[model samples]
Target: MDLFADDTRLTPMPIDDGELWFQQRLPLDLAPDEVMRRLLAETGWREEEIQVWGKLHKQPRLSAWHGEASYRYSGKTFHPQPFTALQLHIKQTVERVTGRRFNSVLLNYYRDERDSMGFHADDERELGPEPAIASVSFGAPRTFILKHRHLPKKVQLALGDGCLLLMAGALQKHWLHGINKERTPRGPRINLTFRLIL
Candidate 1:
């Protein structure tokens, strides 16, 4: 038998100029499917418009913010609604696993294969220096792509159901990441990114 096979901890994903830790599945009281269903039924998702190059356009995906602080990006400010009980629990679990405290969460819902996000980094000034963000996913899998800002390098991750990914260190300073739209039909997905705003 292979030693360390049963270890249920986040594995370090080596990359230049950044730190990544991933766990294929996070143990929870309820199943990932159940959590997905609950979030679908409970969240007040909205399709917000943002200005890109001086033109406003609706974001491809629906999203909600829940936390104690306001967030600003893309020329818009979002004053979050209070976190739900389930979201609070999720934050607690994420904090316990990652050893990081997060006061905010940005939840994004990809309704289908057509929904996608453009490449960007979470390098906002309010995040302070060397910030850490924990992302948890439920439901359909998606290919997450990361591209270096000034280098010809790329990385990909298959973000599956119940998986957790942590982006830390100089990642925001050197890399950009996003999810591209896929042609094939796909089910819905929800991703919650836990963060601490200074």
Candidate 2:
């Protein structure tokens, strides 16, 4: 399961501030379509209502939490559900590539072009300092954006299906990342962000 031990496809994302590794397509035997279908059918996806500026609004996408501990964000607490077999397998694969152990994963389902995530840092207290996040994508491709905390520079990446993006070191501390809503029509997509829940 050592994905980078012999592979030459692993490439570091060209960023000036933080550590990021990007693989256009992970070297895995599982089919992206199959994985997407299974996750859609099996995951208990829910549209959570989050409070922003004292106003309650439904999250644009469906999401589920799986792991060994609870995750708190946006003034809400999410308890972990038992990891599905497919999820555990994928987690192990990502861990092998990133060299990081994750006890929890946040699954986000973007049903269409309108579903999106706003810019934010994954600097929750429970994640501790300098957390490593391994993100895997399936299904349709989407644009992932990263902006510096204080500067005007930004990084834009097209995260393809079956691709893996690893963010470690001071990435979260110095940059904010998010996926904006696409204006053009697009198919559904699933994103799995594996993290260590301390």
Lowest lDDT block of 10, candidate 2: 1-10
Tens digits of per-residue lDDT for model 1 on 1-198? 011112378878868899988888876788999999999998999999998999999999999999999999999999999999889988999999899999999999999999999999999999987989999999999998889999998988888899888999999999999999999998999999999999
Error of 1 at 179 (Å): 0.1
The lDDT of model 1 is 0.91
* Worst window of 10 by summed lDDT in candidate 1: 1-10
Q: Please report the TM-score between candidate 2 and the true structure.
A: 0.94
- C-alpha RMSD between model 1 and the true structure: 3.3
Cα deviation at 94, candidate 2, in Å, is: 0.3
Cα shift from native, residue 106, model 1 (Å): 0.5
Would you list the clashing residue pairs of candidate 1? none
Q: Model-by-model lDDT, in order?
A: 0.91, 0.88
Q: What's each prediction's TM-score?
A: 0.96, 0.94
Candidate 2 lDDT over residue span 26-67, tens digit each: 767788899999999999999999878888899999999999
Please give the RMSD to the true structure for each candidate, in Å. Answer: 3.3, 3.8
